[model samples]
Target: MSSNIRIIRICQQCGNEFEARKTTSKTCSDNCAKKAYKARQRSTNVQTSAEQTLQIKLKPIEDIKAQEFLTVNESAMLIRISRRSLYRLNERGELPFVKLNRRTVIRRSDIDRLFDRPAELMEKSRPEPVALADCYTMKEIREKYDISEKALYELIHRHEIPKQYSSIYAYVPKYRIDQLLSNPSNLS
Candidate 1:
């Protein structure tokens, strides 16, 4: 009878038991090593996917915080207006803004207030005190005179109306509008 022997080996790649022909064998075979490599790659892919999802979930919170206090550029983007137009409004005292160092800042609340009503309605809703004051918001101007935006701007451009700066809006002094209205020649 011929003598028989068996050798057991542990696959270096997968840690599974297998038969090996050589005492020096480490992996079960090249196939097992490749399978183990593929499994590791799959595990890495899952981990990367989970990390990506986590990042995506946190983006909105970060965006909100970023917008909480905004620079001129951010404010312009939020309002869907150009920076140049915003600057014009600032110069004309039509928008509320704060100056910090060399930068111009706008409050999120003020921007929110801008969209709260039609310009006409807002102009009309101001308290009598505000109406009589030196400055008013665009909305207030629209409401008080019952005029279109184009007409208001035309009045401002023609010096037919005098304006003052408040924290918001080019304030059309009620006195000036009254003076102009009293003089029908001022109407274009």
Candidate 2:
């Protein structure tokens, strides 16, 4: 006995014509409200399921396990490195590989060995530089040292880094950068 007045209105929950007892009434009955709520939950669940399926399909390539032999592309994907890097490794005789017809295949064992090696050992295995002076550019030194242009200029002025001027570009000596990199504590 909430009210005797019958206000004609549409049930918002079910989109049907119904007589509402009050002006603020949305659904014709409590059952229709519950039905609408259940429908919303079902739609949300379906959307979530579709999103999860898409995520699964776009998962990172590193999740794949290594096999006995892998193509150049597959090896790059598994290692999470560029194919050009793998090709360079193969060219330098650093990473042993096999040629199967026209395709280049890398052994899983070799990839494992490469991954398992210590970073220091791996770095040492690379070819020696032609000269220490040719190591880093001015921009590289600034970035690696995390110093501003003004600070870099100050350092260059104080340390007197033997720079080679080429039109608008100035190249910093690699030995000086190597010194700072090797002894980060020396930077003031």
lDDT of candidates 1 onward, in order: 0.67, 0.71
Model 1, span 142-169: residue lDDT tens = 6766767866665665553445555554
Runs in model 1 with CA error above 4 Å? 1-66, 122-188
TM-score for each candidate, following the candidate numbering:
0.33, 0.36
Name the TM-score of candidate 1.
0.33
Worst ten in a row by lDDT for model 2:
126-135
lDDT of 2: 0.71
Looking at candidate 1, what is the lDDT of residue 157?
A: 54
Instruction: Kindly list the per-residue Cα lDDT of model 2 for residues 38-119, writing each as its tens digit.
Output: 9889999999999987875475565545368887877887887898788656644457768789777888789888879899
